[model samples]
Target chain A: MNHVIEIDGLTKDYGEGRGVFDVNLTVEPGEIFGLVGINGSGKTTTIRHLMGYLRPQKGTCSIEGRNCWKHAAELKKHIGHVPGEISFPDVRTGMDFFNLQARYLGIRDKTRVNSLIDRFNLDASAPLKRMSKGMKQKTAIVAGFMADAPILLLDEGTTGLDPLMQKVFTELVQEEKAQGRTMFMSSHMFDELEATCDRVAFLKEGRIIDVVDMSLLGGNEPVKEYKVEFTSDEDYQTFLAQSFLVKRHRDDYKQVSVLLSDRDLNALFASLSGLDVRYITQVPRTLEDQFKEKYQESEGTNHAY
Target chain B: MPINSALLRQTTRENVTLWGVLTAVQCLLVGVIGMTAPIAAAGIAYYNMLPGIFMGVYAITVGNKLISSQVDRGTLAYVLSNPVKRSTVIVTQVVFFAGSLLAMCTLSAVAHSLGAYFSTFGANSAEIQTIFKLNLGLFTLALSFAGIVFAASCLFNLSKYTIAVGGGIVCAFLLFPIMAMFGSKFAFLSNLTVVSLYKVGSIMASGTGWAWDLVILAAIGLVAFAAGGVAFVRRDLPL
Candidate 1:
């Protein structure tokens, strides 16, 4: 199967150790691939390479089997992009901008543009200079998606959108996915990717640390975690001594969070039977938790986005 | 060169205001002087410095706005994201820059021509030819200034740097010739700048020698404009 977007050993060095290095990714046709990283983690840099705005110091990027840098102008016809930074050209209003883009794309039909304005709840008549951040983001979103291109490369597309609007954007992405449009989006928002992406890649210090299959995420895993607090220090020590996988331990609070498979549930209960416990509750693990763990594993520090 | 009509329209809309103001100012200055004073007396004063200053202002400001300002603002992403190539964009801007400057000079030439024709001290054919020639020389000079600035605009990613280098060069060119007027010792400074190529004294005296100078000016503009466009096409855009 041919990948809609393929990046091989992509590298861009900005000096002082501040650029993407040996990054590789491939998005299967029609798949929604997500890139999640903290600020300065090379998310934007990677997207810029795909956009052909910056030439990679090494390696190459291709979309629909054409080199991104070599065939940038031709390839862009089928790709919709929401840049990391949004800046409207010299135009009077949002409508003027949309119209200008339509001209560039040779889209004479006004119906698609008008429908997009209505869908985003944008005041197309409002001057671009007076627009709020959220409004500007909506305009960029509309521009990126309005063409109904077969592929989308969105770099932090929903920066200033409200929660409700982000939901609208998510629904739009899902709708586009249903129509078999390939999407490769980068975001700092974990839940957004979790909700829409088929697979997500984590980038750290300009290199991809991991690529996770959404199916292997905590929500679908049979291995559940339970946080248990003991009534006394002796019980806490006794519970810790039990060979269950200890995911977390708080000695001062007499709490131990243990991971247990469905088949091991009976064994966990038998072990706690003789112990005096204060309370036990299921502790849900999310992508955020996994990301934090991965981040700390590599950096040995608890910095998070 | 490929030129997108939409981009051309947008470029025109972005720059027409400054072009209009400067062209009108030039036409007014030339018209008033040619109509009110004798052609020979007003020729040196009007053609020598005022038009050059106006051209400098227009070229410096509009040249920066054409390329570097759009990139600096990141607005160019919208254009580049479309199917249009970077070559098409730079070419379209060059067309706008060259065309607008030509129009500005042509209109001012017509204004001065009519002003001289209708003046109480009616002009001869030689004087009328000098007026047209002087404006033609101004047009080439403006092109040269714009070309240098356009190249700077394409070479840099920021508008400030474009203005500092390109605009700075043009301002220096305009100032050098004026500074040389202070004394013969400073006259050598005039040769250092491109504006000296205009040779207003030669043009005003109906000498054919000024035509060759205009060719050099035109060549500079063409070379600079082409260099700017090629630079824009070859370099990486942050957009």
Candidate 2:
């Protein structure tokens, strides 16, 4: 029940309703809480407040009961962060920056450092200015995680990383989670959040619309969806007459997408036994769909991804 | 101290090439040029004003880049991510500025002393002492100018605004004296700037009050430098 991080009525109004508005959330110790949202959705703003880089106008963000702004220098001792935009110091090479960070953080052991380099396939000897975006991202990842702080704040954590690197980054996050590091991550990738987070919050236009437990989307009582296409119009019409929730129906294609509990699957298949069915496939239910369902009507005009 | 060392090393390494070029140019202008001309006039004209102005310009460049531009470029975010306080970062920047000023001024003074030594064929210790004092005045004066720019760098986030305001004030300080040459009415405007205090002919004529000049320069430099640290601590960075 102890919250490692907590935000209470935090608000910063940047005029024209642009900034975060009355956001409240708590992150318990060892919880990998995810903030999933599209661009310009106040993810960075919220994280900035937690980092004590931005002051809140209305409320407070606290780490272990200490005010973030008042005790920023103290709080930073236990936190590691990766910003959305990465700009390194004016050092000559990646190695130079790494050395500088190590000195600044007072970290001496190079064992974890070398392992991160090997994992990311980073050539730290190259000049920082000459490094590519992916290399820079990898370098930032290593620097942020190298300190091994108990808390991590990552804003768009996997941005600019290639798919292969992203997979590596996700695996690294899982490893960090296993070690009980409390993390607050903002990412546009739903699958990443789905794979790693215990709970994910959906934000839109600087407001938190919902916070969902990922475990609820799985577990004992599961809701499964299946799309059934009938060979003719009569079978499609007959299937729709049965006691099944039709999520979507395309009359032209003679297809009916139905949502039902696992208990209803026997009745559904038995009813379809005599039907002229062309194809039946289970539709994957994902965090993306759950997010869309929450705010689809209100945000219909906004391009999500 | 670690923050100071890391930032200082990075800044010094980044600027070594430029510093080397400036030092060579100072050697040529202050060292080689003073060897041929009449010592007093050359001291007032080339040694006092030229190198002093160059030092001011260099201060402006370094002060602008050290903090404000770094914030604009997003590097300050990384610095702030560390456990170091924002006030400590400003202190580290101030240390870097002072170190750079010391390095640049020491090399220039040595170069000018070599010129004065050769101009007198290695005989007049008095003239070399005078050059040292002159360069000391120039270094302090440049520090005052750089201090103003440092405060501006801390106050503003954008480099263009910092440069415009900082560069504008320093340029006015340098140019007002030049404008005074065309008319007597404008001479009062030149007196208001720090560069006006470096009038070598009058300082040489007075012979002993360089202490007051040094005090004024140091006071202005220290006050501005202190103000920069305070401003950086209180102000919100765009990071």
Candidate 3:
């Protein structure tokens, strides 16, 4: 796989303030990689380092095999970055900002810019200072997309958008992905990432705790959850004896829920073959739960891989 | 060169109008003063000193903030992120500030010279030329002060107290000649005085050349400028 971003032992400190410590991660080309963390968990600081806004005190951060600080201008040309905070002086209108950014990026696509403005439902003539937060976010989104760079680095890109706007943003990301764009989005919202990102890196206390491939959750053999209603105590005891069961919750002896891993689900079903299976529901784990598990594991030890 | 031209055009359009209007207003006020009192034409030279002093003080106080505001506003990162070199940004700032100062000083000098030319009774050609030469020297002296202070501002991120102290130090330097006249025995302090350059100008006005002093002062200004450029390229922007 062609890696678009390669961060190796990237460490930065802010003189007694909070910053990243020995972060390492690789984002592949055309992949949507999510960086999930709470506020002040070094998400912004890491993004800043990637954007070449801050130099790492130790280690290296490279984009497409180019050192970020040494080759910032060249790297920036291929990376469209949206800062966590969207702030422009009062004089710049949405259109004016687009024009300025386009000129700077050396993009001559008037059609692309117009399409982005229309799709985002942004008032091109509205001054940024006078616009609402949602409108400003839309404007920033338009600018980021209009650059048409191979990589998109979004820092809290969905903060002020409404639900419909967020849906539009997801659609836009899909379109970018279709065009083979690599997107690295840092967000606090797991659902957004769940719907869009292929992989996620869970960050906690200035370190990456876990890196998960969402596609691996259910491989050829799918993990399934079953809420079995036992007729008597004998049935419950028989199900508990099976080794494929990963977790079981039994409030009373009548009903019990079992969570099985993908590998063990087939064996578990074989044990229940020819028996009256009350109900077999294949429920996938929500991104929130997976993220929580990763976060929990990361709190005790560093498990970035 | 094209990119530099485009950047320069943008900066000029933004800064020139304000600088021009203020300069015109100062010139008109001085012209009115010189025209109203013909016998006090010698005093008009002293009156011209007011605006020159104001310009020096304003440049020292405002130049650093103007350059540093780009960093504060987060625009410096955006600009640096472009394909332009760090040297280009520093050079652009120096050119912008220098051009604005030169334009304003030229306008002020012309207005003051014309006022002095028309108002003086029995004034010879030599006297008029001498006064013009003095004003030119004054402009250079004032620009040097601005350049030095601008360099200092770029060198250190001054706090409120530091700014106050800088202002106090500048005021003392400008007022050193007056202080020296009042029985201060520290004769070596004259070398540190900008007003002493005006005396040099006065002496040189009578067909003499203080080329060595001018060369030394020009070297000081150039050094300050070079230092400002070095500081700009090395200082990390606020994250």
Candidate 4:
């Protein structure tokens, strides 16, 4: 299938180990694809290349089959972007800046822009210079989405946003996806990606080490992990001997983490009935946990959590 | 259109204040000098030096603001992310810069002419022509200075580098002419700088010979502007 966005063997070496290296990814139509990495992990560099702000040192990237570098301006007609940095052009207020952008994008309709402004609950009257980081980010978000372009390339689009606002952003992303828009967003925030992305790529030391399809990850899995603590060591030891898969156990705390499929959930509760059970809580297998495991494994270090 | 009118409007809004203040000061200086002093005296005293300094300062600051400072601040990313092309942005800015400079010189010329026309001595057409020639020469020299700084502005992502190189070139040009004033040995220094091409002496002497120098100054400006525009369009922007 032809990708909405395709990056193949894309490399941009800023020297001293500071650039993206031979990265490859493709976002299908209506998919929300994410690039996740720590700071300086080449996320922004990759986005900039897609934005055509940098020429690839090796290989090429394209949007809708057209080269990003050669057809950047033309491609912009169908794409919206939120730069990593939030500095705005010389404009007094957020509304003015949006108006200017609207003019450039040639969007005569203010309905989408006004709706986005309202949805974000942004006070467009505030002076941009005085706006806080979160406010500026919201302004950038509104600008990026207001164009209603079919594709968006966002570099850390949720930085400085409050948790509630981040939810709003994710909901916005989901809504856009429902409308059949494709997004290629980069963020270090795992939860944001986990909530919305269909697939997430882990970028480490300038290279894409892994791209995990979200459907295959924890939340969608049939198996679940539960951490149970027993009042007595005998109960903990006995629980460990059960048919349940023991993911890990703590001797001092008398706790055992059990992995059980949904069908075995009744069996788990039935067996735990006789034990001097203190507390039993489900341990969610989050994307952070998965990323942490992969991240540590790739670094050849133990960042035990 | 190669020029985005919306971007042009934004660029003009950002720059008009500075252009206004500088243009006002230049016009006032030319007017006051022409009103009180003779053409030959004003040519040597005012036109030969002061206007060049003002232009140099204005050119250095605005040239950076036009392209390099935007790139440095990462604001250019916002501009570029839109449907607007790099050539569109560069060309629109150049049009604004060239237009503003042209307007500055034109206004100053009018002020000088009016000042001489209303002076107690009531200047002749010959002397009035000299005022226009002097300001015209000043305009071309400043435009060339604008071009150099603009090229520097386009070539670098940092304003410090743009100011250092572009501002440095204008300063050197302005300095060379003053250094030439010290003595005969330094007289050769005037030939080394573009400011000398303004030729206040030649214009004050007569209008005929100074036209070629003005053409050279204009040509230098065109070339610099072209190089800067091409560099901005072709080079990779970190933004």
* Chain A TM-score values for every predicted structure, listed in order: 0.89, 0.91, 0.89, 0.88
lDDT of 2 by residue, B194-236 (tens): 8877767655563677768777887888898889888787665
Model 3: per-residue lDDT, tens digit, A52-137?
A: 76778898888999987777767877888777866553236888777766666677869998998888888999877789989988
TM-score of every candidate relative to the true structure: 0.92, 0.89, 0.85, 0.92
**Fnat for each predicted structure, in order:** 0.84, 0.57, 0.26, 0.79
Q: Which regions of candidate 1 are displaced past 4 Å?
A: A222-241, A249-256, A260-284, A300-305, B123-126, B205-207
Identify the superior model by lDDT, candidate 2 or candidate 3: 2
Native-to-model Cα distance after best TM-score fit, residue B124 in candidate 4, in Å: 3.7
The residue pairs found clashing in candidate 4 are: none
lDDT, candidate 3, at A11 = 86
| Best candidate, TM-score | 1
lDDT of 3 by residue, B72-128 (tens): 555554455455555676677667776777677677656755775677453456655
- How much is the lDDT of residue B129 in candidate 4? 80
Using DockQ as the measure, name the better of candidate 3 and candidate 4.
4
What are the per-residue Cα lDDT tens digits for candidate 2 across A10-101?
99888886889999999999999999888888999999888888889999999989999878888988999988889998888888888898
Show how many residue pairs clash in every candidate, following the order shown. Answer: 0, 0, 0, 0
* A1-305: candidate 4 lDDT, tens digit per residue: 98999999998888999898999888898899999999999999999889989989899999999999989999999999998998899999999999999888888899998999999899999999999999999999999998989999999999999999999999999999999999999998888998899999999989987888888666455788888999999988888888888989999999988888889999999999999999988877777887887887877743443
Q: Please provide, for model 4 over B10-55, each residue's C-alpha lDDT reduced to its tens digit, 9 standing for 90 to 100.
A: 8889988988998899888888887888878888988877889988
Q: Model 2's DockQ?
A: 0.56
**How well does candidate 2 match the true structure in TM-score terms?**
0.89
Clashing pairs in 2: none
RMSD of 1: 3.1
Writing each residue's lDDT as its tens digit, candidate 1 over B1-239 gives 68999999999998888888888888888888889998878878778878899999999999999999999999888888998888888889999998999999999988988888898998899888888888899999999999999999999999999999999999999999889999998999999999999988888874489899999999999999999888888788887
